[model samples]
Target: MAAVSVKASKGWQKPPTRLYEDNYGFGINFYQPMIDYLDAKEEKRAPKEYPHLPWSNERGLERYSSKKLVKAYSEKDLRRLVEARTKADHGAFTLTKPKTHLSLTETTSAVSAINRKGSTKEEVRVKKMSDDVFDDNMEQLASALRSAKAYAIGKSAKAIESHLLAESLRNLSSNTEVDIRSFQRRAEVSSHDSREHEWFMEQRKMKEEELEQLTQPLDQLKVELLGKQTSIEIEQLNSRVVEAETRLKTEVTRIKKKLHIQITELEMSLDVANKNNIELQKTIKKQSLTLTELQAHYDEVQRQLQVTLDQYGIAQRRLQSLTAEVEEIRGNYEQALRIKKSVEIQLEESVSRINELTVINVNLSSSKSKIEQELSVLASDYDEVTRELRVSDERFQRVQVELKHTVEVLHEEQERIVKIDAIKKSLEIEVKNLSVRLEEVEANAIVGGKRIISKLESRVSREVVSKTKISIPYSLKVSEEKYRHPPRWRNWSTC
Candidate 1:
């Protein structure tokens, strides 16, 4: 049985070190106690100096044994030993030999029998000495028996513990294996999903780029249309301005020509009137002279003198009408000169107005150019803004898609987590059932006294259980953390 335990312990030692080193990469010191326990178990005999155990004295058991000062084992000591043995079975260190108690008891009993057989001559001294030695020996024997009983009890208890621990470890190992397989499956599915998501994102990006390429020419066309319309409007305005200028020039020239013709006509009529007045004056002068000569011959003929006086009066009336006509001609000439001067002033005013109109036209043209420039700038700005809006809209859509993807991923992870939780519950139920079975095994092991063989097996089982305790929850926590947060692409939604 001891050889089996040693072999089992040796076999168990390598796995934990390898498992921990490969999977967790923990330092070997973490399992140093187990290594030391295995080492102690493999030895054929106890070491002269045993390693410190909780039940042993700090100075060591060998010191007490060598000095013959070993005290009788007390109930408390036995209890402590039992507890320590229980701890040892659960991966703590313990050392014992099945022969020590028996050998010591036999030697003491044989020495007492030899002393009791001494002759009567030395009876008193021998009896006193033997009595003292015998009392000490008896005490030692009693202590050894009690220790043996305690060892047997502790051995039974340890066996039960080992059996229970082994059962629990077996269940835990099976459950952990299942969990690991499920986790690996989940990892594979998540990887496939991630790859699909990446491919979809690339496709979306490509489509967005294509849309931008197609829209470029359309935006350019819109800009060109706007420019053409503005140019057309500018040309129409320029044409209207040119037509108005020409009309004003034609009207000014026509008015100046009409004024010039009217002044010349008036001047010609004045000249003809002046010439008629000169001729009439000459005729009147000649008539006056004829009258004077007729007066001289009046004395010769009284009837002829009366005839001459009538003719003189008629000629004087004619002269008076001629003077009035000459004066009217002078007044009309003055009015014609006044009209000419007014027309000259009006022509000068029209010329100044034309110049102002030309300046206004130039200014209007400049303003039209400025307006065209502004319209071009506005069109460009509109195109830019539209392009930016389109890009933003595409980004928003992409973010929406990403958000949906993330949400779906989270949902799937949550479903998987729920499944994992269900598995965990089932494992817990199985563990409970195993614990019940272990308790039954413990009862049977105790009744049957088959505890000694289970020492190393218990240690190995407890170690396995401990490793599972550390590793499984950590993996679950990592998976949970990975799925808890959303993806990085969701940041674009804020934009």
Candidate 2:
């Protein structure tokens, strides 16, 4: 009858008091009206429904078997299952990363929470349920044990099992403080332990959360320590530093080598360039001197040409004077020619008387031949003398050959003497000019005399230079020996 009324309630709210008290494992909802009814049912002699349980679902028992957990699973087996699950859930946990340690702290904290004490006895008994509650776990555990022994008697095994179950559920439901009358009548449980366990569970949950919070500091400390620790970061940084140092060294060495090479090349290039500049300077100096010498020669030539032009003008005036003189001589020569012609006529008359004498001379030469025969007859008386004369004639011809040889020898000697005389004459002329020039140079070396000596020496040197070369006629053209015998100035050789 009690179970029937609970199933039929339309206004029964959920949680701590909705179906039966044991259902509070979902959460405890205390319903004051439902509590009054549950109190009423506690005094009844009938079976009742209890909703929440550790293993208590009608359909689940039929299908997946919550009953199997009750009948087949022991407390130790459940404990093992929970442990295994915890391990499996966190199998990948390692302390390498900071997150892993943090997660471990959380799990430890959760486990520590589960080990907490229950609530107080008086607290459990007086704890006001929600006005719309459905079920509670502590309520259900006390009820099931209360009816277990009673349902065991006077029934078939299957029926006894059902009754025992029903009665157990009924006891479990009444144990809740929502209705004190159900299992409190004759029960092994006390309200004190029940409430204490609840309070302990709550304290344990807070402790677990506190433990997790504590682990945060520890995790932070671990991360800080790792940062200070020696690892790949520092090693790689050192390697990079070493590599940079080596590269810098190599760069320095390369730059130094390049600089040295450049210095050597620059030095050599400068040396060559300096040498070429010096040679060019010397060549420029020599060319400049040659230009000055050429300029001086040109000036001398210009002066000589001017002097020759002046001399030619003077010669032209002299030629006019000589022409006038020759005209006066021509009048005298014509007068003398006319007088000679008169003398020639007197001579012709005298020569005609001489021509008759010349005819008498021709007759005398014819008689002279007969006289020569008489002379021959007379010479027979002097034959010895004629023979002597023939011998003297032969000797005279021999003397003529000797005289010709002597003349040829004399001519060769005369040529040699003439060459020597020519050389002497040229030397004497040059010496006379140079001696005059020297006396002028000595005077020029004196103070205030240099200008006058230079002028006079130059003029005299020019005259001597003109007289140095004697022009020979074409028929008398000789070898270079003539010029060779001429005196050369000391300055000409230097030139």
Candidate 3:
């Protein structure tokens, strides 16, 4: 069995048919040499014991177990039995074919038909069914057949084993008979010599035993190859299952992680939305308060605007009345200005007249001073004539005549002096009248005349008063005394 397993492992590298062909060629070459060697050594002394077969228990079973052999044989037999049974039932089981392609409606109808029929009559009814009915009943029939096959396989393990052993024995006997007949024919041809005949017979027996030994190992090799093939298939299936499981686990973990991330994102978005909603509500409240305040402020502004408009109208009317009053005052001021101009003109004429009167007074004062000097000389001459009259009587009469003429001249001079004095007094009265009129004019033209009056007074005092201070001679005073006392010469003239 170990050699067979080794051969199987080597043979797996090549195709089965190619390995079998190679083995057949090697067996032919190997046995030919052995056969020739055996014939040449047949005449020598036989060895004490023949060599053991290469497939003996001590060699083949060193690394193999009997339980594994039994299990493999059982499984192989079970599969063979199931195949045989299915082949036998093929004609009766019409629904087994074309089961995979059946429609829903067809399956339903077939299911109904099967449920209505008895188990004993099922085969006959199924045989009578048409192709459509076969398709319709395909799935259920296939499932039922699978269950039946499973049960039969479970119960028939020993029977399958016995059947396999019987078949192997029968094949071995048939091969032995064919080989023995060929060997007998060779023995018969060489029987002319009795010793050769016996030698051929012994050789035939050895070959037979060798053939028997070879047959058993070949059977074991076939079983081992079958087991190895089946094990390879099972290993492939197991690896596929493992790969699918790993792939499914990775896919499930990925999906779970993705779902967790999405959930976290949704929660964060919800929090942000809540914050935005709260902020919006706060803004709405603030806007409402501002709107109310603005409305109140607008109303207050409207009231103030109305009050300002009314005040503006009142101020405009007051301004119109004030303008009319200003126009009346302007007319009165113009009339007062005209009156002041006339008063100023009259005052200027009065000042010019007063200047003329002052010049006349100055001339009169100068003429009076000259007349006083002349009168003083005439009084001195009169005094001298009176003294000479006392000194000589004869010259007295001539002096009296001369004195009478002088007295007449003096009388004329006195009349002239009296006229000059009267003119000076009239001039003084005119100046007083002018000053009074100027005062009256100043009082009436009160706007610009007080300064004018003060200026006129200062000018009048400087020009008129300084010129009126005239000096009179003392001789005039003596002449006035003699005239008042009436001198003795005048008394003598009267006597």
Candidate 4:
């Protein structure tokens, strides 16, 4: 919580300049006690023995050293000798451990002297005096006890003698005056002793009664303690039971929420499947319509091609008949020309008639060749059309196969949808039963604490919070646009 508080503070981002300067300010401040203890220890010690010994700083040591101490050491040449010895010994270069002999000589001598002189003499003196004195006290106590017994016996005998003499005097009443006076004194002392004894007995009885009265409250306190122990145990058991019940309630609620979420997810999945099925059906219908229109167009083209082939065949047949007629005419003209050649110089009329027949034969042969070429071109076009029709038929068969596969897929999807719907219905019934059970559990739950547990009276049950169904649509298309495939976040519905 402190860390959180520090993080929340504005100054956390930028600390004060003093924060870095104070070595004691950073990290844990728990060392305050240790620091105080060190300070206390320092306060108990004497002031610095060497004030001019370069107390806090170590640089330029000779400049800070007192002239008197420097002179004293220099005259004795002790400083140079110490430095020379330190330089000679490898270990002396660094003061890893103090020279025990030199550093603690005075301290060790003082401690040993104090212990030998003070502790030993005091211990021996106290031990010897205590033994002798206690032994004499024991003997003195025994002698005092013997003396007190002798004194008590003598006093009792004296009192008894006094009492007896007074009794004898009373019996010889009407005696001399001096005898009466002695008798009166003895009676008064006896009477005073008896009164004091009676008063002491009364006071002792009162003290015993007071002690018993004081002890009675203690017994009551014991009984009260027993009751308190029982109550505390009962309270502990009650608290444990309450904790267990609360834990169970929370667990039940968590399970219920998990089931609710699962149901919601399933419903959403069903919705998505349905929408996908619908879209698939629409696309299939559109594709089938397009295929049908294309097939019809191809069929019409095939019909037109067949008609053109028929016309080409007719044209070829007509050209054949014309060729045969032209052949017969060419033979007649050739025979006529042969006879005209024999009588060529004899007649101009025969020559003119032969020339006209030759021109007619040439025109017929040209027309027949043109008709044959047209027939060849028409046959090529017919073959091309037949190939196109065959390709179209193959394409139509492929389309049919694809359509069959799609239909099969659609049927499978439909079956799954039906199964899912059945499962959904069963789940709904199960959920209803679960909800009813939950309500019963809530109704049966114990409440009203301890007082209610002892009684068998009917109590009003608490209201159960029922889960409501939520219908959430799942659209792959929209989701793809918004979150893409493999969604990064959960889509939830309000319930």
Candidate 5:
């Protein structure tokens, strides 16, 4: 074993300096402290037996003790190990290299402990860890503490002052002296209530001035109305004066002329009355002849009235006879109408029967036409066969005899077909049961057709899918680089 020593001249001041001896082995404990202690052993010294845990054996402890193998990771332990490693380099042979991607998690049987938080229970747990593990955990804790200290130191003075100020304010508010008068003054000033009140007073003054001005216009209008009323009263007085003056002037003029004109007009009226008397005398003589003519015309009108009454009596008698004849004719007409209706109904029925017969005839004609067509075809065949038969008349005669015998047999078969049809009808009535089943049968025919179409479509889809399995991807990839192999089960093994 080669040895390393951590000297004390440096700052490390924990325990006494000890030798590090290499017993770096793997798959067993790699502690080095036991190894170094064992190396310090002399021949006179009896061997000291220690704990025999898995990591405390001679080989395990040696490897654990060696600075190269033992993973001591605290700042103190690591600094010691580094020095020991440097010293070890001076005296050592080969040493195992550190793993490149070694994780704290991957190192078992090596220091992998981390510091628990500072709680009573956590301290107890941390205290129970192995020395190497405890060292690593302490080193990590000390590093974290340093980082926390550095972070605390990095804060600005202003930030500290702000925090302190906020805390002081919170404390101050706990026992504050509030003066509502100050707050109310600030509220009233910010609200601008006094300025608003002054503005309101100014607006009210302006409105009062405007109201006074408006009332002045109303007074002006009232004065104008008074003037108009006074002018109207004066005009009424003037009209009354003019009426009185005109009335007096007309009265004087009438008094002077009224007597003189009245006398002259009376004389003229007598002359006119004499002239009217002469004219009326001539008119009366002329009207007397016209009145006599009118009397004669009145007698002629009365005679005509009498003649009309006699004619009316004759017409009334004739009308009575005509009415009697018309009543008889009405009775006959009613009978004729009924007969006409009966004839019309019969005609309609006959026409319907004719149409039915015509349709039947058309159907029969079509059947006959079909029979004629068959006969024509048979005749053509017969003509051809007749020629062939003429060529072999004896064979044809034998076939004719056979056909006659076959016709007789067909006659018997037709009778049997009739019997079978009766039996089938009887069986259908029992087996089909309900009359409603006929509708179901018809519906089934329609469903059967639809099902047939669906089945064909399914078959076509299966065919399309089958063909697409090979062709679809090829068609899609037509513009791409050609595949080295087409789709095959060999390449699709994973799929």
Candidate 6:
């Protein structure tokens, strides 16, 4: 053993000095004071011993655990260790070679002291320690502390990465949820539109049925009115003879004056009839023109309907093509899903293989090289799989984006289709209304023609009666009797 002294000096006070003796050492008392200082500075910490817990005691010591021995840590110990490290970092610490050393023993040791001016002999005691063992223990403790700090830093970084991954996944899930909701809304809108279309179609059918019912009555009324006009004309012709005779008997005395007055009235009535006939002809021409214009408008409507049909056909073809493309994409997605499942299974198998390798590697030294090679191969495969998985994840994200876009496009198309359907329904209703109006106008025109014909017949009968009264002759009786029986077919073409 060797004796060593550590001298502590103050600026204005006598220097303090301490001596240390190495108990179990090969003349290592020269450096014992330094060892004592390290021990004291470390706060009398014991040599770090592994905690023999129940779990650890059961296994005693796994081969891997034995090789990878770790020191247990406490916060207070860590803080003291940091303070000591920082103290050492801020100051220059040098070990000086002690002077005066010859023989050393446990009891009578050589004094190797630090040279100091005005030093007092104040006795300082130091704890006994094995110099070699103490040195080895301090180095181990330092290494353990460094490993612990590194592990803590790595763990923190891993935690941060995991947090970032979780956030990304959450955002992705939220986006997917939004997309799903949009799709659901679109489906609801489409279903609503379909219902509306069905309702419109039903209304159209009902309207058509009503139009047919109305048309039947209108046709029947037209035929009945024409027959009534023909019977009224026949009755008026028979009454004309009696009316002419009554006029002749009443105006016998003033026949010549009456004849002159009657002549003027007949001429005026004839002119009025001509004027009315001309007006009637003009109205008929206008009505014909209106009918022609209506025909042209109907033709134009037909053309527009044909164009709409063509457009509908084109849209159907486009829809079919889009459906085919969607189906193809679905197939591709299924294949990708299968591949992803396979990759996941492979990853699980690789993880199991890695665990087995860890166990086998510890037990078989002769096979260590082979196991390392296999582990390298597995690591490469894992890396390859991880890369593939990353590619799959990217593809999945891209597919999701594409699906979202497609869904939006589909929604737009559905809205457009709904709008077109609404427009078509409106157009159909307008066309039906126009047809109904046209039918009503035609029925009114027929009724107006019947009324005009009746008035014209009455005026012609009165004119003939007046003419006969003014020119009563011997042949009038025969003519009147002949007029009583009208011809079988009263030449309506000439009339």
Clash totals for all models, in order? 0, 44, 0, 0, 9, 1
lDDT of residue 232 for candidate 6: 50
Off by over 4 Å in 4: 1-283, 345-495
lDDT (CA) per prediction: 0.45, 0.44, 0.49, 0.43, 0.45, 0.45
Cα deviation at 160, candidate 5, in Å, is: 99
Q: Residue 86 deviation, candidate 6, in Å?
A: 99
**Top-scoring candidate (TM-score):** 3
Q: What are the per-residue Cα lDDT tens digits for candidate 1 across 216-283? A: 55335434543454345345434654665688779889988998998899889889888988998898
Against the true structure, candidate 5 reaches a TM-score of 0.18
lDDT of 2 at 443: 41
Among residues 3 or more apart in sequence or in different chains, the pairs in candidate 3 whose N, CA or C atoms overlap within 3 Å are none
The alpha-carbon deviation from the true structure for residue 349 of candidate 2, after best TM-score superposition, in angstroms, is 4.0
Q: Residue 326 CA error for candidate 6 (Å)?
A: 2.4
lDDT of 2 by residue, 42-140 (tens): 856323664333333333333332222324576557645744543444342211122232223243445446543328653344222211121233223
Better of 3 and 4 by lDDT: 3
The total of clashing pairs for model 1 equals 0
lDDT of 4 by residue, 1-495 (tens): 012222336656675333233233221133443555566568674344422323344422544323212123542265446445444433211221123322121323333364343356534543443333333333333443344334434243334334333433332232223223433333344355777446545644663475355445533543454345434534554565466668878998999999999999999999998999999999999989998998999899999999999999999999999999999999977765664453333224323433443343344335324432332322323333334334434543453354355336435534554243444454345435544543442233212112232221121111111111111121222333334312211110000
lDDT of 4 at 333: 77
Candidate number with greatest lDDT: 3
Per-residue lDDT over 333-352 for candidate 3, one digit per residue giving the tens place of the 0 to 100 score: 77666655654454466457
- Please give the distance, in angstroms, between residue 394's alpha carbon in candidate 2 and its true position after superposition: 68
lDDT of 5 by residue, 1-495 (tens): 546766676666676565644333432253344555565574334357643445344543543443444344776667567546444433321111121323222222123244334476433422332233434433443443344335434354344334333533432342112212222333344355677556545644664475455545434543454345434534543465456557766986896588668768877887898888788878887888888898899999999999999999999999999999999999977766665565445446544644553454355345434432332323222333223323333432443354355345435534554243344344334323422342343344345434544554565566565654635453444313113223321221211
TM-score of each: 0.15, 0.16, 0.22, 0.14, 0.18, 0.18
